[model samples]
Target: MWALDSGICNSLEQPIKRCTAKVIAFDLETDKTVKTVDLSDILKPHSRPQYLVTDYSPNGFPYVYISDAEGAIIVLDIHHNKMYRVVLPRAISAGCGESDVLYLLLVRRPKNQNMVIFSYLCGNKVYGIKSEFLRTGRGSSAIVELGSKTKHSVLLGTDGSNGVILRYRSESELYKWNTDQPYKECNFELVQLAEECRLSTHVAPGGKDALMYSLSSNVADYLNHTCGAGGASARLKYISKECEDDCY
Candidate 1:
């Protein structure tokens, strides 16, 4: 199922009627339920000039790609609001783009050095991508960085390519897996890893052939509840497995 982050919770009422902040949540395909959570209530945002970064966890949770004034990735306990900045070796230029698959790319190229490790919080798990794997000035503009998916096995994808890699974009790089192929340029705007790695397209379960109950709504209509990825963190509320097909 595909989802976006604009919803009623992020809406304002009058002349000052609009939230500048983006609200996040999830949309389940089985039942057209737009599950949204108010982030403002979840995290305290400072009212100062703060550089921002954002990415979605594997299951579509907004795994906030947070950073600080000094270009350092901030690791935090989302539920408790505690934060610790994991500084990269040097300032790295980065951007967030996803492929046909579900892996998020955190491509960082440090200006001062040829290596930079990526660090950030996603699915409530702290992760790191070292610079050795991402040799900055390498022959190929592409580099294979590794990490795991919501499913445990390690996943690797090419970051940055032979394109106009914005030299100034140093916040975070998001990617998706479409297939096992190393990379395939996406016709879609998002940076896709390949067709093999893309997450399965979801459709509402209906009719007699339907083993599950799918909530109906435009994929764009509802906010999806982010199920923290790979079961790495605390369990979010699980409603049931009573559908035609078990979902456990």
Candidate 2:
């Protein structure tokens, strides 16, 4: 397993100090760290790094896409021990704050692992680019805007296949969209998983069987009524094959 350590701070209330951070590789069987990569020199001074493991290469090397405070993605090639920085277009990343850039999602295409899709939750469009282009820092024309529309809902996650999961603020059902489909066609609900509690969706790790899961909770009610007096009920559930078929 691999993990990123952003260093320590004085207290929980205080922000993390602008210190050097490390990416550690561990041997699960022996429970020992095998290697460590220092980010002090590669990362900009005082920049904060957020770890995001979304896809892997055809050769099976996991791509570690780290989002920094400056609205740029630091793509780490673990197998080759190489690193590259990816900056979004000015129209998409300009004037974006740390929190705004954190919402950008990167997912690899199931049909073609060499390609990657990038989307922002608040933005009306999605972009696609070949992974090779990012590695070589080549042609800007290689990055293409795949889709665009006046979006009203927020993106939840990917289906781990070709679909992008989304949901309205007031709805309980999840919707999906693919590159080939029109915006209005995305109204089809992938699942009606909850009615009362709020739901958070996640793509299964490693994209196994293209499965997706959700964690539903009534924490809003608990906070409003109990005021941190007790624990709120929650359930972890995966969307099964039967559920997926029924949606179609």
Candidate 3:
């Protein structure tokens, strides 16, 4: 498994400057750390970095993409032990202030795994770029304005295809849309967990198959009635139409 080390910055007044973040990998069978990649040197001064591991390359190279909250992404080639920084175009980063959060999601094309849809949510808008362009460290002009959602919308995950999953903060239904489809037409309801309250939902990682697993819990009862008072236990549900299969 892979995990990030945000470093020792929590107690410091100026936390960003003291962060010594790194990424670590572990062996599952033996439960031992196999590798540790220090990222302090490449990260922007005083900036904490967030990272996501991409699926193995078509050529089988392992890659890790890191963002330092700057308008750029740092691509680390784990196989070659090299790093490249790719800056986002103004079309994607323009007007986004320093306080705004940048959310990145990697969605592979169903037809071609070699092609990756790199999507980032900044403010209320989501933008897309081809991963190939990012790998080349080029400022791509092919950036696509995927769509915009209400400021209250939360990005759930991808559909193991081109569809981006999302949900309104006040709603309990999950909605999705293919990147190629019109944003206004992205009202396809993927699932509805509850009618009265919004459930906390999370899509599991590793989009290897058509079937996706989601974990959900009714947290409103826990909040309103107190911990363990009326809250529902977390449940695992399959995203396929055969919802009754292997649910727990």
Candidate 4:
């Protein structure tokens, strides 16, 4: 029951009410209620709510985690309203594991049209994505979308920021940056309106909606590459034109 805003506490958006108070916690930065906890009607005692509940769901709803908040990691299930807590350091601007593997946060820099990729190591130390000093600046936002269970990348949307997102694959030559080439003419008029961007992939057999970063609403004008598990198998299939059995 962390109420930083004296205003929104009394509102109906919060998790619980007087007769059955069910709110697990509340974040101060993004003023909004986190309901649909993994647990129903269960309660836990905390020394202070303000000490936990960091930034959450600035854009997409129901995707939230309090790092090291629940003595581990706190997973609030939006669909069922249950709370599952896991112990992990919930840093504000980080979402990568030990290796530089997962896709870090990506933002665009307006100054020089560069990108910034925010990464984390050992799950605690925070790192920034840079490419030859052409990336990163202040007041930039970072968004990390998991490309797949084993692969992920940061989509740097903040213009002029040094958080460039680069894609990496196991057992293959790592790819360079994923910046939108200016000279390549876009085909759609709507894509021309987007201020920032994030590229996500999905599987058609899995209904295409269950893929990584599937919660995103933007799916136009970007290269939609199919991801495969186990690099060698994916490559062998690609060489044989048998990609459909895996990709689709």
- Candidate 2: tens digits of C-alpha lDDT, residues 75-106: 77777888767766667554445455343345
lDDT of 4 at 124: 31
Return the candidate ranking by TM-score, descending.
Answer: 3, 2, 1, 4
Better of 1 and 3 by TM-score: 3
The parts of candidate 4 lying over 4 Å away from their true place are 1-44, 47-61, 68-70, 89-124, 127-248
lDDT of 1 by residue, 1-248 (tens): 32333322532233232454333334565565554334344233431112232333334333333333233434323343443434333212232121111122344344422222232222212133333322211211332332322322112222232111110011212233332222223411233222211131121223364232212122221223343343222111111222222232
TM-score of 3: 0.73
- Candidate 1 stretches with Cα past 4 Å from truth are 1-17, 20-23, 30-70, 74-90, 93-248
**Model 4 alpha-carbon miss at residue 92, Å:** 15
Candidate 4 lDDT by residue in tens digits, 149-197? 2243322222123212222221111122333432111310111111123
Candidate 4 has a TM-score of: 0.22
The residue-level lDDT of candidate 1 at 88 comes to 35
Scored by lDDT, the top model is 3
By summed lDDT, which 10 consecutive residues of candidate 3 come out lowest? 112-121
Candidate 2 runs further than 4 Å off: 8-13, 26-32, 46-48, 59-62, 94-98, 104-113, 139-141, 152-154, 168-172, 180-188, 205-210, 217-228, 231-234, 240-248
Best by TM-score: 3
The CA lDDT of each predicted structure is: 0.28, 0.59, 0.61, 0.28
